[model samples]
Target: MERERVNRKIAAIFAADVAGYSRLMGMDEEGTLARLKAHRRELVDPKIVEYYGRIVKTTGDGMLVEFPSVVDAVRCAVEVQRGMVERNAEVPQGTRIEFRVGITVGDIIIEGGDIFGDRVNVAARLEQLAEPGGICVSGRVQEDTQGRLEIAFEDAGERQLKNIARPVRVYRVRPSAAAATARPALTLPEKPSAAVLPFQNMSGDPEQEYFADGMVEEIITALSRFKSLFVIARNSSFTYKGKAVDIKQVGRELGVRYVLEGSVRKAANRVRITGQLIDATTGAHLWADRFDGALEDIFDLQDRVATSVVGAIAPKLEQAEIERSERKPIGNLDAYDCYLRGMASLYQWSKESNDEALRLLYRSIELDPAFVSAYGAAAWCYVWRKTQGWVANSAQDKIEAIRLARRAVELGKDDAAALSAGGITFAHIAGDLDGGAAFIERALVLNPNLAGAWLNSGWVRVWLGEPEVAIEHLARAMRLSPLDPILFRMQGAMASAHLFAGHYDEASAWAEKALRENPNLQQGLRVAAASHALAGRLEEAQKAVARIRQLDPDFRISNMQDRLPAVLRPQDFARYAEGLRKAGLPG
Candidate 1:
């Protein structure tokens, strides 16, 4: 293939960004955004057009411009700053939106309506150095603009900028001094927020539009239940239904951190829902998954799609937040930050990480005593310990776990994450099978879209000795979060449910699937051994038993009941023990 040619030119680059953008958003997000939009519409754009400047692209809080002459660029920057000063005259100094403009005359590469190269980088860095409502220029720009304009230049000495090979002298333009403080601006909600745009009907049938619109509405309603998230109302999200949207623009307009956009394709008896979660501010694709099912189960399909999408993206959003928190200075860490960090550790699925996660979670609770999710997650850490055999029948541990679970349930009556997590803790650690199942069922009622809740309910059903019911719940959970980080947990539960239901072949198959993802999962190994032995796969069963021995040398059939859920039916436990004996496990 012939390579596309490169384009380069010497241009005067103008870069400007809002000062203290984050703080401004935090203070009065809507008002700050409204003012910024008005400023751009009335002052900044007009000045740039008057100066013969070409607008390149705009980030959420910043814009880049190009001019043929450095003098024109400097003039535009000066006029914009002057206009801002006038606009802020009637506004409070603290809430005023201020622009910091940086002009540099340098070579840039242009392609596909975007400019690139080191000059662009320098302009951005220079913009960062400018004071609020002020203008800064490079030596070259200062030289070209000098005496060509009425603006006075203040000599800002040579400064070494990041990633720049050489220190470049800078000059500040003395536009009428405008006072702007590092106060608040329009910011996304502190809690993770999202908007679900209407899904396009790609079936080439106009009548299918309702199905697509209904999908978006259902998703918006379901996502609203995540008390940890701020979801845009259905009406607001539907406004962008058929429009070709810019994700960043949508994010700003809706004030959300993420946007979910997708399309629905239907053919006789079958429909497919495809969705992609995007980081609205940065336009990054965080996650994407598709669900395909029969059209006869239309409502159920919608519910499944909503649950799966929420289940998949919730963790992705949390992971994105964790990454953002990781970038903050250590001293700036807050309770939420600690909670995110703790969750990051908890997901590692190791003893040491679980311990660290518990410590951090408790620290979060200490920082904010009313943090319900922290209590729930801390309780989950205890559940993890027991499941991993790190703790066994410790009455004190069980009491502490129960205490945390109860507090979580009491405080977070409507929080699905808190409820589901607490439910799992109660069931697995405290052996309150009925109460645990009730908590999870309530969570499902509150947020039927929560995959984790479905997963928890499935396991509880298995312990309740309703193997067939457990299988259906587990299958639903899998459909809801096919790519979930804890997918192995769901798979292992399926294996157990199948083994108890006497589908030995299906049980072995699912056990293998679980072990494929988590080779050292003790539960998976035990299930694999039992299923394989019952299915007459003698060699495979013996090998799984050997591996289990390596993981827990003291393991024996006599004490297996301690490892399994205590509520397991007597006959189910006997069958499992018999299978293990057949697999050559010692009594």
Candidate 2:
């Protein structure tokens, strides 16, 4: 006869242990055990029962508890810590006892009165990872307990626990001291800075990797609405592909302070997403969460994930306010899917990719005309064509770009992409410098988190002969899109702005920085040549100009209007032209 196995519906399993338990026991085994018993009897047991938690068992130094709700587990954990803190305050420093606790919500098996499963194993591991006297919970528990407690939680990111089959997302409830420390550090930046990394694909389908990648790009686009955040561009972050990296390293490499990483998994009709934020300097987990829903409800999932992420970083983020900002087109999930596909193509940055991107963007818009991002992207394609001189019909291309950009603005007046692309088109092709600058400014004011708006607006300011202002905006753009492939553009814009403002030394320095990243950056070359000339370094100016001519044989200052955007004020144009002439560009 086979032995009978008991099954029970397990909601959450909590495991806790004292840090340095062995050391304490070794020093005074009987005394330690006696104190542990006293503490359990006087504080821990009562609090667990108060929270409606069941104490499954207790070792000499640890305890295992089960709860029907994750909230109960966390509340009990907080109470345990608060009680311990007060108790320790009265004891000597050397004799003070501290406990590390971990909680997870998962299915488990019950044998007799003891619970056993991977869930229990995971909680044990998390407890070990927790700092002494701190509480760490899995992503599931964090979501389950959110808004049900008064304490704030910080994301610890995903950790590959010992013997675990997969990485676990973890969160640490901000300890009282940590929370107090954070309050005084809440000095807002003149411009906010952010980073978006590739979202993980949990679906176990290798082919769906592109879909996950597309989702991240879409998020970058969406968040690029706020002009205040210095958004790290996608290319910069994607460079770390396929590598197991620390978020702190990412922050350092990208030169941003905050890092966002997440994973996406989809199966049939269900989808699951996990995300976390980390402070780069301290390697501290700032926030972590998991969102699971039906595949048909992906839009809601994305919005919720974005909202949660923003709220984690900026506690003041209000759901009601974000919901009222704008809404995407409804009834066309396929179109939205296609738009994501198009974004993947656009990120490739080659002519072949651009062509494919155009096709997909147009197809998406055809499916849903109100998909404003698609229209904005289509307009960008034309801008790319004009910049690369790849257009077979410049007149027709500009006309189409202008039309698409205008339509994007009309449909997405509140969207960052629409305002950004429209402003770029108007400034570059339509020669509406002031109007374009104002539009970009409006986009930034409307969405302080939008990186693109700041970047484009910085360029607009440069064109308007306000290099000082341009540099300020461009620096903020760099902060927002630290990983952006087009970061060279921002650097080049800064150099050009400095050059136009007659800050030759600063221009040379910034141009060199840009050149270090991309040796063949045309704008950097132009600015470097001008800076060298203005600073009376004729030899370096000639060398830079030579490189420019080699790269573009027909390069000339006067004809630059045809090759570049026409958003420049007269003063700005003259300043650049004089620099080029001084740098020995042929008339």
Candidate 3:
């Protein structure tokens, strides 16, 4: 006999899951299982019952439920998630038991007290699209729950669902705290302005999430190197992290005209990165591209991705910047003076000068902590010390470097000087390669005329595996500061960039220029030796090595990581080490 079809009615579906269920299980079976049961008993079950929700079924790591009202469902979801945040206060990010929630209001078949329909399916899909500690809901659910609930929703646009009939419009639910502390909508910049939104880590492994962030940060720094864009600070842009964000809303919040977004996926030593530039005002795509490479070749991959994005946007941004500069007035004199004084000390490029520069910077910050340039210069002092091999205490220096860089980025969101300096140190000292790049780029966007930002940006680009772009940026820095007292530093960096790119002759030429000003410069001597050795100029390479030995008779290729601040990538460092070995550096 044929069974009667069940009647259909409107229902609110909620989907919930542990952020990293498999990972949690892999890390600890009995403990994870115990925690899940304890959470369900203490929190999840109580909320479901209180909100008039019916538990349809339970998967070991997730649950599906039907609520009588969308309001009840959303409220319960938010509370449960918020409770988790408080529950995880003492827990580290690496192993937190965060929950992602997805709610939808839709039609469902009522059969034997179990619901079956696309509404339930949509909720599941939205959950998949949510950030680890966030929530996602369908448009209808957001609409029905609006005004009825005190929650804020961000339009995530249409997402293609697996095994679904059509694209679904999803919105991300912002945490209550984020909404409470939200900045007043900003005034758009007169010039071209942009914010590189944090890249999505499409890689399922939570450990690789930082890789994606680092990539975005590099791109932001790269784009900032261009003098024409008003770039928002990394901290501001990151406010949207783990939230489903509307592009237009991001523009309004950040006061930027353009927005760049992307994703990174890594698996089995291979990585695929994809990015798109958008006209935030029009919701139109300006540019898009994908980069694929071996994971070990990550530095090169990041450079190519960043270079392409920068090349695509330069013309448009330049036009906007000129327009804005015409409308904007100059900076404050006292603050500017203090910043310049700090710069004077920085340019001296010795330990005593670095110390003096730091003192001047501290006074500048005291006078006006808003002077982002001073913060950048201060952070650079630490980087300089590390590069010159003068830091006697690595651990304490690293801690201080990170603390200062974090503060510079926090307080100097609109300042290019602050971002670049802080961003570079974050990489070298804190090992936050992605974050450092982002801040540096933001600085470039704020004040492209800042020659030092370009100089430091060039150095990081080489570390990120874009020696070609590094050379270009350094060249621009030299042009901007034709007679700069620190001109030798620029020339030496250029030499290293060329050496990194395997352009031996160009490396040799730039190194010679650097040596002309500071004959004892260790960086210039090292690059000249390495490039000459690799290019088969054995006599010249040996001569360069002899000079290097004169400066530091204890130098050896074996201690390359400790000695060479520029070698962040293993392959590049190994290649340079080999060249040093060939040039007869001991060990």
lDDT of 1 at 320: 38
lDDT against true structure, model 2? 0.78
Ranked by lDDT from best down, the candidates are 1, 2, 3
lDDT of each: 0.80, 0.78, 0.77
Q: Which segments of model 3 are wrong by more than 4 Å?
A: 1-340, 366-371
Greater lDDT among 1 and 2 belongs to 1
Point out the higher-scoring one by lDDT: 2 or 3.
2
Worst 10-residue stretch by lDDT in candidate 1?
A: 324-333
Per-model RMSD to reference: 23.7, 17.0, 21.1
Estimate, for each residue in 391-504, the C-alpha lDDT of model 3 and write its tens digit. Answer: 778778777777778888887776666787898888777767777777778777677756677888898888899999998899768644444546888999999899889899
N/CA/C clash count, model 2: 32
Supply the TM-score for candidate 2.
0.62
